[model samples]
Structure formats: C-alpha cells, structure tokens
Target: MPLFVKDFSWEQTDKVVFITVPLKGVKASNVDIFSSEEYLKVSFPPYLFECFLYDTVEDTDSVAQVGNGTVVFKVLKKEPGKWPQLQSDVIDNKEAMKVKRTEAFAKAEEKLKEQSKLKAEQKRANEQYALKEIMKAEEEERNRIERVKQSERQKATEELEKWKEEQRLAAEKEKERLMEERRKEEAAEREARKEQEKILKRQTRGKKANIFEQNAEGAPKREVGKISVSFTHRQFPTPERESVKPKEEEWLKKQAEARRIVELEDENLSEEEKNPMWLRDKGNEFFKAGNLEAAINAYSHALRLNHTLHSCYSNRAACHLKMRNFFKCIEDCTRALELLVPPVPQNADSRVKCHVRKGTAFCQLEMYVEGLQDYEAALKIDPNNQQIKDDAEKIRHLIQTETVE
Candidate 1:
C-alpha cells in the first residue's frame, strides 16, 4: 500500500528519454531502481514510482543518477521517433499495469543473475591465472638455484684437487731435503771416525816410547783409595717417588662406572662394542645407509656414554634435517656447537657444519635474518667455502624482496 509518486517529470528526444523523480527526504542508499524495455520502477520505502512507457526503450543502455533528494534517468529509445506521452494508456487499467510490473521485475532479476554469474567466472579465472604465475616463478627460481649449486660444487672440487696436487709436490720436496741432510750427516760422521783412528794410532806409538818411564812412575803410585757411599734417609725402606695414588684410584673408579653403565644399558653389546668410539662408528654406518632411526639411536647411545662427543650431535642434526624435523635439527646443532668450544683448528670443520645446518633449519622456518647470521658465522670459519657464500647471498636477496613487497 505504498503511495504513488505523481509529481515526477519526463522529456523525450528522437533517440533518448529523460526522467527525473523528486525523492522528497529519502536517502539515496534506501532507493531501489529497476527497469525493463517497456517498464521502469523506483521504490523508496513508503513511496513508489513506475511507468509503462508509451513506446519500447533500450533498458540495457539506460543510466540513473541519484543525488540531492532526486533521481534522474536517461533511457534510450528503440526507434528514433517522438512519443506522444511519457506513460502508456494502460496506466489507468490497474489489472494490465500489475501484470506488466510482475513481468518486468522477473526480467530484471534474470538479467542481474546472468551479470553476477559472468562476474564470478571472470574473478575465478583471474585467481587461477595468478596462481599459475606464482608457481611458474617458483619453478624458475628453483632451477636457477640448482644450476648455481652445480657450478659451485664443480668449482670447489677443482680447487680441492689443485690443493692436493700442491701438497703432494711440497711433500716430495721436503722428503728429498730430509734425505740429503741425512746423507751429509752420515758422511761427516765417517770422516770423524777415520780422524779418531789416526789420532789413536799416534797416541799408541807415543805411549810405547814412554813405557819404561810410565812403569817407573806407576810403581811409585800404587796407593789404594777407600770410597764412602750414603743412602737417602727414610723411615720406611722404600724407594722415593711422586705420589699419584689418589689420581690412579679416581681413574679406576671412572672406568668402573663407565663399564657398569654400558653393561646395564645393553647386555647384547660385546666388550669391544661397548666402547663409545665403536658406537659412534656404528652410527656413521647407519647414517650412510639411510637408516635414520638406527643412526639416531646409535648416536644417542654414544652421547650417553660420552656427553662431550660433538660429532655425534652434529651428525644427529644432519639426520634430523633430512627427516624435515627442523626444530630438532636446530637443537642438535646448538648442542654440538656448545660442545665445540675454543674454536681450535681440530674442531673448525665441525663448527662450520653445525652453523650451516642450524642456518638451514632457520631458513626452512622462514627466519631468514637468523639464518643469514648463522651462514655468515660459518663463512667466517671457512672463508673459502663458495657454497656457503652463495647460499647466504640468496637469503639476503629473499629478505630484500620480502622487504620491498
């Protein structure tokens, strides 16, 4: 039971029609406008305005502007001709106008559904295209990284071979120098022995000449001498020695404890296999064979026997990394690094491995900055490692890309 808006105005040209409706105090957001080839309707809560046009118009090309408490519509006519009136004569026939309104509303709803469907299809297509582009970019990046890795590995291998050749040559030179020095020393010793023999012969001849005089002097010097010897004073009749009794007892105690622990942990282990070094070797074999669980168990057993085994922790971290347990890998790497203290040449390689492994885990977790720091630390330890340098540079580029985005 909405009231009809009767004060609307309209004008027409040969090819177009203009309609303006006063919205009174109605807001634009509350207005609803719908149009078809022959009918147009505008609803604003209690007010409604509609028209069955005098002639067919192009609703597809129709446009509406709403502002300042008014709505303006510009509709195109199907035929380029003047109209006698804005609305048709059926406006006075309630039944006919009602039927027309229902038909027009249904046509407008169908058109809206088709447009919405088309828009959805277009949006879906765009998203799929974007996804494909992203995947392609990722694939290209992976290929580039693989190529770089292969090149670096080849270069490192060549450098290692050249270094080994240089070492072999230098060792040969050192060996020849040592052999020549030894020969010179042997010749000098032979000459000294010959000279000593000549001196001894000359001395013997002189002694023969002085034999009569010496016998006379010896006869005068036939006196005996007595020598007194004293032993070190001690309350106990035992030889003196530094006291190491307590140290020996402590070492024996630790050995006994280690044996007890090993026996209790695994009765199947033989006496030879109970050693920590044996267990570590077993772990290495298991790791090389790709038995990660067995390797981890072996490494764990070795660590239990000897907690200071940094190599066991480092190797276990490698296993964890292969298993994609990144957090566990980082933990093992950290533990290994802690055990590899003082930064000695003997432990330099182990330190570098731990740093690189931990960095890899960090990068897997998307903590690029932390990963970069660890890689840099590894590079400091092994400055000649081109692989680590390249990896660090890639991470830096990723960080930059993310930051820019």
Candidate 2:
C-alpha cells in the first residue's frame, strides 16, 4: 500500500468522475499519474498511491487540476452515468474481485436507470408532439370543410336565382301561348256566328213574325211585323290573359292516378314485400337518395305498422342529422337508444353508432356537455372501441378548447 494519499474525496458529475487528493507540501512536476485498464497509480516524490478501477475509464480523458492546496484528478467515464464507488477497495484478490463485481453491477444498474429515464422522457415528448400534430390536422380539416360549405352555399344561391329566372321566362312563354289559343277560339266563334247569320238571312229573305190582332169587324185578322236579330254590339273576351303568375299558382285538375294508390292485393308479391320491412327498406332508399321528407313519411308509416321496429328510429335520426334538425335528431336517437338499451338489435355496433351520432348532433348544436356525456356513456357500453375512444377524445378536446375560451 502507498501512503501518498493522505485523504481523498471522490465525486462524480454528469460528464466526469473526480477524485481529489490533498497534498499539503507537494508541488507540481513531482506528481506522476499512471493509468491502465484496471489500475490507476499516482507517484509523488518517493511515495506511490494506487487502486484498482471500479469500472472501465478512458485513460486519455484524465486531467489533473491544482487549485487552493488540493490536487484534483478528473477522469471521464467510458460510459456516461453514476458509479457506486470510484475505485475498488484493494483488500485481497478474492474480496477485491467480489467488490469489483458488485461495483460493476451497480454502475450498470445506474446507467440502465438513466437510460430508462431518458427513454421515458422521450416517449412523453413524442406523445405530446403527436397530439399537437393531430389537433392541428383536425383544425385544418375543419377549416377546409367550412370553406367548402361556404362555397357550396354560394353556388346553391346562384343556382336558385338562375332557376327562378328560367322559370319566369317559361311562365311568360306559357302565358303567351294560352292567350293566343284563347284568341283563336274567340275568332273562330265570331266567324261561325257571322256565317250562321248569313245562312239564316237566305233562309228567310225578309224576317217577320205573325200575331193575331182584333179588327173593326171583330173578325180574325192576321198582322205581321218585321224584326231583325242583330249582334252588332256584342263583344267577345278579346282581353289578354292574366299576367304571368308564379309556378305555385298553376293549378292542375286532380286526375285519378293509379300509382299514387298502392294496391297491396296485387297477386305478384312476396309476403315480406308488403310489410313494415319493405317500408323500412324503402325509407332507407329514400334517405340515401336525399329525399328527407319522403324518408320521414316512409319511416312514419313503418313505425305505425310496427312500433317496435328495430332500426327505423335510428335511421330516421340519421335523416334528421342530414337535415340539420338537431333537436329532432336527438329525440329520435333517444327513442332508438331506449329500444336498443337491452341490445334489442343484438348488434352492439348499432347501439354504439347511435350514441356517437347523437353525441355528434349535440356537438353540432353546441351542447358540449351533453355530447361529452353521450360519448362517455358509449365508451362504457363498448370500452375498447377505437372509434368511440377517438370520438371521446375529440369531445374532450372541444371541451378543453371551449373552457379556454
């Protein structure tokens, strides 16, 4: 053993492990440091201090600094982390090996802990970054949808105006045609009357009627007087047809239409084609075609036939959603949920769909809390459904943003 080290203090930092040996009278140029894979030696003026390394150290990375009556040796660790002890206590070969092994394991564990902490921090940062990116994408999508809807509204307004102008022109043309037809009929009737009068004049050369009158002899006397039936001052309806009216004013006489009345008794039919199922299917078709009013009517008819029909109410709720009838959508969804609470349709997915749709409708109406509640309830029904989770996440974000506002 070397007695050169009077007392030593060892410390470690993020980048380097430092061991300070206090030498009271020793000066520079007299200290020599020797480094090896498993040993470190310091010789200062006829005395030598040496110890076996606890773990691997970079020999070239060693530096010696002298300040304030102390000599400090800072050696960079081969791996960046903590060490349980700076060097193994050189007691004996077997005991020394045991200490070194334990120290090595301790160093390895400390490095592993640091690496684990770093990985955790990185994972959290990555999650935050991904969340930010998702929120940004959602915002962009919403903005794009708003722009598209605005453009569509403007286009629809322009198209409506153009249609109105076209309808006005068509009505005017139709009015003119009716007026000409009326004029032709009146002229024909007048011409026919004139020909009839001419024929009547030829039939009776001088028109007269006879009446019996009393004479002075009180005998029968025949008296005649001329009379003419003239239509000189008669006028036909040559006035113009009424001004062009709106299309709504055009009345068509109701004629019997067979298609308007369905005869269910027709021979060529299946049993399933005449019932609520058929009506429900028909309503679905109407809904898909964008005939919301007809869909509503068909759904109503089906409900009347079978009040407990499984999906009609839900389908009707979808119709209301498309119509922007948010309240009605909520109502229909509630009804469907009531029917589907015990898993009536035996399709949990259908129930989940209803919940999500109703929640979305509530969100559309700006009832955020209700929407959030719905989403949470749906998650309880189907905890692992990814779509429901996503919807719930969206609702939570909306709530958070609204709270910020």
Best by TM-score: 1
Displacement of residue 330 (Cα, Å) in model 1 is 20
Give model 2's clash tally.
Answer: 0
User: RMSD, model 2, all Cα superposed?
Assistant: 18.9
lDDT tens per residue, model 2, 261-373: 25324467556545778889999999889899999888887776566775998999898888877778888889888887566436787787788889988787666789989
lDDT of 1 by residue, 180-240 (tens): 9999999998987788777767757645544344444566332233466988764334455
Q: Residue 152 lDDT in model 2?
A: 60
Which regions of candidate 2 deviate over 4 angstroms?
A: 1-274
Q: Give the clashing pairs for model 2.
A: none
lDDT of 2: 0.74
Count of backbone clashes, every candidate in sequence: 0, 0
Write down the TM-score of every candidate: 0.46, 0.34
lDDT of candidate model 1 versus the reference = 0.87
Evaluate all candidate structures by whole-model CA lDDT and list the values in order: 0.87, 0.74
